[model samples]
Target: MSTTTTLEAPNTGTWDGGNEPMKASYGKLMMWFFLLSDAFTFGAFLIVYGLARHKHMPYTGKADDFTFSTEWWPIPEKVYNAFPGLHGMDLPLAFVALMTMILILSSVTMVLAVEAGNRMDKNDVQKWLLWTILFGATFLGCQAWEWTHFITGTEEGMLLADGTRIFGANLTMNQYGPPLFADLFFFITGFHGTHVLSGVVLLIMIFINTVNGVYHKRGHYEMVEKVGLYWHFVDLVWVFVFTFFYLI
Candidate 1:
């Protein structure tokens, strides 16, 4: 009867609100909400991409506009080259792969910075944050290289007027994929890169704050912790991107 009553009666609410929080300040709360919204935005984009990839296969723009119509999208392995280093190399997803590693590493460094902040260790914080910044810069450089490779033709063929696809020197109608596939690749990766760039700028701001002793003067460096959360969230987004765009 007590169990039945507990189940049937109006449920009591949490005293602190609908759910317990992570004992964060208002800034951290806002960051969590912001990350949640950003997550939904990226999720919707990937879902749409998946739907398209399943529905319409792309064409191979080769021999001055080789075209193919199909029931699915271009396999990503066919696209995304790096540069002169990987001439005629299959996949050439190495740059993006390296990019993923750097991003994950930067997230680790950011966490360390937060730890240092908690301990009020300014030198430790600066050192780790510098490493984080360097990793971020490296990721950006790799991204730029990828974009450059896409823009210029390698030993393989070049893109169509659509500016979204590429072809090997001998891409057949049945072999090469669609122009739209290229389009989506550039669009999706570019958007994610922009986010990374934004994160870098924010990181710089926090770095400046630390250097200026803003947090130290205030007696706590929770700002570093909050920013670290954002950095980690960006890295998490890349994991899903790599799985869907590369490994899968």
Candidate 2:
């Protein structure tokens, strides 16, 4: 009798389609790529804004008494002093600070939802997702209010070089500092607000799916984790925007 010896295949130390690629699912990897591209877009916008800001002269007037002019950039504290339902009070960065806090709270709730998903606790996931949606909506509402105030401009208004007084901001003219400032503000903040709105819509859909047992039936909650990634990215971008636009 002749015996034949069998040889085992050698390990190549490479992904062979036997598990998730790079230890992450295809969906997750795609989401990351999309976010990376988005980050580049935001970065470009901010970089352009920075270049433009550097080309202008800085405001040297007192925050409370600064007058708008094309000769110099308006102080952020002076321009953003208005607060909702509290006129005649100089509350610089107050509303935006509240908006940032709300966004941060939403991120926290999203974390809770992701954790609940890990535990496969559908009820907890649903509860946390609902809170996250609520917070996102609140942030959007605050943004709308801020935009309205910015468009309406200040009651004092600004006197133009043409011997005419103007109030509020438009795409062409703004009562606050250089026209470029308003242009950048509208573009950047509006872009970020659009992202937040999209996030709120996605969260609502995710909440619905969770309520319908969609993820539960699938035996995994990866969908929640994916959206959580996006939510966190939005919150992080807002922090940068807040710093660049308001604080510094």
**Best prediction by lDDT:** 2
Clashes of each: 8, 0
On residues 104-181, what C-alpha lDDT tens digit does candidate 2 reach at each position? 999999999999999999999999999999999999999999999999988878998789988889889989978999
- Per-residue accuracy of model 1 over 63-122 as CA lDDT, tens digit each: 234322333454455555444475676655666777888998999999999999999998
**Cα shift from native, residue 192, model 1 (Å):** 1.0
- Give the C-alpha miss distance for residue 45 in model 1, angstroms: 0.9
| TM-score of each model, in listed order | 0.77, 0.91
TM-score of 1: 0.77
Task: In candidate 1, list every pair of residues with a backbone clash.
Answer: 56-72, 57-72, 57-73, 58-177, 58-178, 59-177, 59-178, 164-182
lDDT of 1 at 159: 44
lDDT of model 1 at position 109: 96
